[model samples]
Target chain A: MDVLKFITCGSVDDGKSTLIGRLLWDSEAVSLDIREAIERQRKHNGQETVELALLTDGLRAEREQGITIDVAYKYFTTKKRKFIIADAPGHIQYTRNMITAASNADVAIVLIDARFGVVEQTVRHTLLASLLNLTQIVVAVNKMDLVGYEEAIFEQIKTKYLVLTNRLKLPKVTFIPMSAKNGDNVVTSSENIIWYKGETLLNYLETIPIIPPQTAESRFQVQYVIRPQGSDYRGYAGRIQSGVYRKGDKILVLPSDLPSEIVKIEENLQEVETAIAGQSVVLHLKDNIDISRGDSIVVQGATVEVGSQLQAYLCWFDEKQALTNGARLLLQNGSNTVKVIVQSIDYQLDISTLEKIEVEKATLNAIVKVRLRTAQPIVFDTYNTNRQTGSFVLVHPNNHHTVAAGMIVLNENE
Target chain B: MKINNKSFDYLDALEAEAIYILREVAGQFERPALLFSGGKDSILLVHLALKAFRPGKFPFPLVHIDTGHNFEEVLAFRDYLANTIGEKLIVRKVEDSIQKHRLQDPKGRFPSRNALQTYTLLDTIEEFEFDACIGGARRDEEKARAKERIFSVRDAFGQWNPKAQRPELWHILNGRLDKGENMRVFPISNWTELDVWNYIRRENIMIPSIYRAHLRECVRLESGQLLAVTPHIRLEPTDEIVQLPVRFRTVGDATCTAAVESSATTLEAIIEEVIQARVSERGMTRLDDKLSETAMEDRKKNGYF
Candidate 1:
């Protein structure tokens, strides 16, 4: 069985958590003890429908307030698949939490209330999911019973949602109309909606083909230089982010463009002929090139963009301060962090309408475009090509806190 | 050996993710140590770390906070594994902090040194100045641990502000630590209890024998919990000791950890039992969690890993 990491995003009172609860209950993922605990909390909260949100609301503050704040991860396995749901709060810090949840997610479950007919949060979450590079979108139009289980309403919302996905360039879109509160079209398709000819939410999720991302040229970012005591071995250790490398392949070290041939590839002390993406291995080059930590190596003919200037889209995560021009921060990409300055603040994105508003400063939760200058030339690919090489985090130099996240935009000239 | 371009199943993907995190800890942090308790999770972590960096020796050493009331079998197994692997092992006892006035042992019934182990851990970290401590804490263990970040940052006093954690993205782990602050990295944060058992079954690793069922004298607590009779736990007058076939779900301190009546003896039996078990692994084993609703969260805030 494969694992699917999906996130449920919607505004408050949109049945996001209840749908998750129904899935767990129907799948028997929620055991007797956990169910009893949830029942107790629901009674304490003085609620009716066994407040399934209590299961994911793990914090004391969030539980007491009956609200979810940070991102909470829930794992469940049906017979066919294992699922990891990144359930997050809807209203406040929505973009930040969605980024945290959707960063490594394979799909996004955008819950829309049928009565509301595609609210603002639906658009914002879908856009954020698109921006995070999640290609699969499951638009679960929940609360169908409120609108009398009408298929027309579901079609209207899906049409409008498709218009938004078209703008966001998300190709894979799925729509299922269901009343999450009544278990209609969730795990079992509702008989009331006879016109809808789609699989149930769980069935679709279980059977959907997880299209594998295409592999690009091999990009190995050296995380640590492993040199044991008394033994002279300069092993550049890291997980290969993309493609594959075979022994004796000619590779070029970044920044300096130093050329070297791979003399050996070792995985767990045993020399192997080849190394693929996601396997942590140590590589020994033939020549003693000037290789250090934070340096990346690529196959000889692979094209890697090496520059100091970057056109990037960044999200401000710091509530204490805002991002300003000439703001000095550390730009961390892969395992490397270098001093970087904000060259210019470009424009702010109005998430709801997908419109650009030119702005000079970015506040907390502000997604803006900016140009940055690193102290040293860094190697990167476009974010669309390879996420590992193209993504970076902005760290505060004074406190060493991660303040923002950025995705490098590919310039047409490059 | 095979250059396969493909996705992964549940366990293989989890193993790769954990290995990647272990590599990051070695790459970014200075003076890091793998916090080993000889428990199953820690043992699995050690095995994964072995696979991560083996040709060039593991960059970090293994450190254990000896809670002084561990099972003899577990301690012996711990030493054997460390010696067999030829890795450096550091043992910091809770008695050291008790003598140093930093910690005090409990005297009442259901006395738990679980909370006191934090002081010893912090002291050991300060003594060695370890910038990162790799733990085997999984998110599926408890509610509070569920929301914990993979690379959880602790303050100068080792307090975890769960509300103010740095958002981790992709495979890029940020390991920047200021002076006096450290990180508790959980490589297996994404794995569940069932996943751990499945991996253990597949890998066929050697663990402590205490996990297998055996006839042992146990006391039935007033709260319907079973307590293993150890030298540290003072038996009460009303306590009823009976020889029952039981096995330990988790390997913690002898006094605080509880055992459940079981007949499962082999690794296959344990995996089947785990699949059928209702409560979580810690729900029946850990005595510290039943003290309060937010006991794990409270302890985490006070620098307990």
Candidate 2:
């Protein structure tokens, strides 16, 4: 079985947690002990039935507040596939948490309350999903039971969501109307909604084809140099960011642009003739070219933009620190961490409006386009082409907190 | 390495991600150490570490914070595995820390050294100035751990502030930390209990004999949980011990790690049991976590792994 990572996001009280709880309950992922604990909590809280949302609220503060504060990862497996659910908080203040969850998710489950139809939070989530390049979007119109299982409400919400998704240019989207609290159309088809005939949420997740972006450029950044003691062996160790590398393949070392031929590829200490993307391997070069960590090894003739100045989209994460022009920070991409200075702030994104707003500085949870100049030239591809090579994080030099996440954006003229 | 198949196996994917995290631990930190507990999870970490850095000696040494109240079988296996790998192993005892600090031992029938293990762990980190401590913690084990970042940063005192955790984006781990602070890296944070067992079966990795079913003298609790009658636990007058075929789902301090009756002598059987088992590994086996609602969260805040 393969793994599929997905995120569930919505406004507060849209039942994102309840929806995940229902899925786990129906899938038998909820253990007996946890079920008992939730039942006990239900009685303590003077509730008639067990509160399924209590399952994901792991922290004491969250349990007391009855809200999810941070992203909680839940895992379950069926015969078809293994699923990783990032149950992110829905509060507007926790948008950074939602962005963190979306960074690695294959699909985005944007929950829309049936009673409220399509809200601003719904539009914001869908827009962020589009920005993160999540091709598959599942618009879960939840709380159908509260709305008397009305077909008109579901249709209206679906239409409203489609308009926003189209505006964002989202390629693939599936709308499912369900009641998370009543266990309708979540793991099983809902009988209350006879007008709906789509597959259950679980079914879609199990059968969804995880199509990874196709890239021809082979890129590998050396994370560490493996030179065992008392041995004449030398190997460049790292995971292949994209494409494949075969023995005897001519490769160019980044920055220095030194030429080398792959003499051997060692995966799990065993010699292999080829290595594909995502596989960690040790590459033995024919010649010692003064290579070390933070150096990239790319297939010769592969188009990789190498430069000191780069234009990218930045998502500010620090609550106290704001992003301004001429701010010096550490840009860490792949295995390389270089000193970088923000040259200019092009525009800040209005998440709800989906419009670019002119700004001098971007605050917390702000997404902005900016230009940066690195201390040294680094090799990268557009984030659209290669997510692994193009994505980076900016770290504060003194406090060492991750300040922002960046995605490289290349101009057509460049 | 050759792409003969279009689809990727979940185990292969988990393994690749784990190896990548291990490499990042080696690449990012100035002094890193792998925390080995002799449990299946940490054993799996050792296996992944070999896959990660084999031609070269592991960039870091294996460190184990021994809570003296540990199973002899596990301790023996820990040493054996470390020796076989031909890597340096550093063992620090909680007993030593307790004695040096004149700390009070937990008073109970099954006095757990779980909480005290953190003191020794933090002391070890300070002693070695290890910037990163790679562990085998999985998010599926507990609630608090579910929200934990892969590259979790801790303060000088080794306290984990869940609310202030740095946002980990994509695979780019932010291992940058100030002096006196360290990172607690969980490479297998995504692997579930069943996934670990399945991977072990697929790789045919050797685990300690305690993992397989064996007849052991255990005191049956009123809650139907079986506590191994180890020397660490204070046997009561009314306690009844019986020999039963039992296996440890998770290897922890002898006093707090409960056993479950099972007849699964093979890895396949263990995997099958894990798939069908209703209770989670922690819910079923970890007696320490049953003490309170936020037991894991509390322990993490006080620097316990």
Candidate 3:
């Protein structure tokens, strides 16, 4: 089955946990014993009905305080697809945890309480998802039942969210009126709302195309060099982030561009005739050309120049330190780590507004565009085209802390 | 050969990714060993290694930290698997540690040697000078495991500091470690329980028969778990003998392992049973996990694989 990884982001009491619990409960993905445990906990808490949020809240403090504290993963599979849900706490303080969870997610389900409409927290989450380049956003207007299932109320919230989406320029946005508490338009379609003509949330998720990092035109990076012992069988080891290579196919080794033929393909010890994008394999060449880690193997016409300077968007994750010009750190991209110095701080984008805010200091939760100078030539593509080869993380040399995550930008003028 | 078919593509992709990691470990680390137990996860690891070095022998040997209280079926199956696969098997016993006065023996009949397996493991790593030990720990298995990276770094003392892990970026796994330090690589870190079962069914892998349910002599514990009646676990005066249909989802030392009463005799039935199970397998069966909130993390710090 095709795998779909998604993350749920919202503040506490927005029914983020309840929506996830409802999806799991209605889909019959949760086991019988877990359901019983949640039921029992609900009765012990003296609730008239079982609280779905009790299923994902595993910690004692979380259960007692009724708030999510950390990122928890929940798994469930439907007949058509498999889903891994990264449930992150909605508080502002847990932004780091949310980023960690959403870093790998293909879609971001940003839940909003229908009564609250487009609040600041909603904007914060939407901004983060946009900043991370999460293409799909599901603005689940939950708590519709509390609004008496009124279509006008839903429309008002939807319109407000559309205004926010316009500002963020999200690639894909879907608004669904849902009552996560009562299970409306979540897993099961609500009969009360016949005016709405859209697939149920689960149906949409099943059909949504998960955009895996597919870039056919960008340069390919070779991560490691694998040599089978006692044999002349040597190969370039890495996953093909983009493009395709076949046996007897002619290619060029970058930084050198020494042309060679794809003699053999070794995925582990098993040999294949060809490899495509997303297949992590080792490619043996016809010649004994010097191809090492930090070198790129490219089809002759598909090579990009190794650039020493670049502009990129960065997210400052360090709370204790401020990122400014000339901040020295190790910038790692594909198996190559180079000493990078921040050359200039262009501008910082406000988390909620997405507006360029002129600031001398880019503090925590600030997203900024910066120019960087590396000690060595590095090969990369623009993050807009290829996320895998285009992104880099800055690690503090002294403490090995990941201070910032950078997205490579191709257009310097824009 | 046909790009038209995406059938088995995900598995093929995941398998290739895992093999690439295994070969990377072989090339990067000076001394590395594949940590093998009789468990299905580790067996999958062995299979991956075999595929990783086809036409040649595995680059490293297999190490099993024996608690000396393991189920005979598992031990026999372990040896059977090793011989059939043609790999070197190294067994380091906790009993030897006890004999050398390196470990204190618990004086009770139902003593747990689960936590003490760490010393034996750490000593074996030192003895073999294995700088990297590839384990079969899935992040979906437990909460502490959820925080683990694919390439988990361990300190010189075999301590795991979750807060001090290296930032792993897109496919750039850093295996660089200081002297006396080691790494624990989990290839199937993203795989869940259901995924493992599905893969086993798909691959038609061979597993010990104990995984399937059968009649077993057992005693009920305070946690509502059924413990298989064994020689090491002496029956108390009040404890009564009961024969129940049971099987183990996980295999560990018999002293600490618990069984669930089931009638699942096939992988299909087992998968259905797993789908229906309300409590997690680890949360239900493992007594050591229920010991404390940070039990798994604490054990990992003390070098328990």
* Strongest candidate by TM-score: 2
Model 1 lDDT per residue over B58-84, tens place: 888999999898989999999999999
> Candidate 2: global Cα-lDDT?
0.89
lDDT of 2 by residue, A309-374 (tens): 899998898899898999999999989999999999999989999899999999998999999999
Docking class of 3: acceptable
- Tell me which of candidates 1 and 3 scores higher on DockQ: 1
Q: Candidates' TM-scores?
A: 0.96, 0.98, 0.89
- As for candidate 1, its clashing pairs are none
Give all candidates' CA lDDT scores. 0.85, 0.89, 0.78
Give the alpha carbon lDDT tens digit for every residue of B63-86 in model 3: 999988888888899999999988
Off by over 4 Å in 2: A213-216, A412-414, B1-7
Interface RMSD of 2: 1.1
True contacts kept of 1: 0.65
- The CAPRI category of model 1 is medium
Interface RMSD (Å) of model 3? 3.6
Q: Which has the higher TM-score value, candidate number 1 or candidate number 2? A: 2
TM-score of chain B of 3: 0.95
Query: Candidate 1 versus the native: TM-score?
Result: 0.96
Tens digits of per-residue lDDT, candidate 3, A281-344, equal 7778888888776777777676464778889988777888898888888887766678999988
The digit string of per-residue lDDT tens for model 2 on B72-172 reads: 99999999999999999999999999998899999889998888888999999989989999999999999999999999999999999999999988889
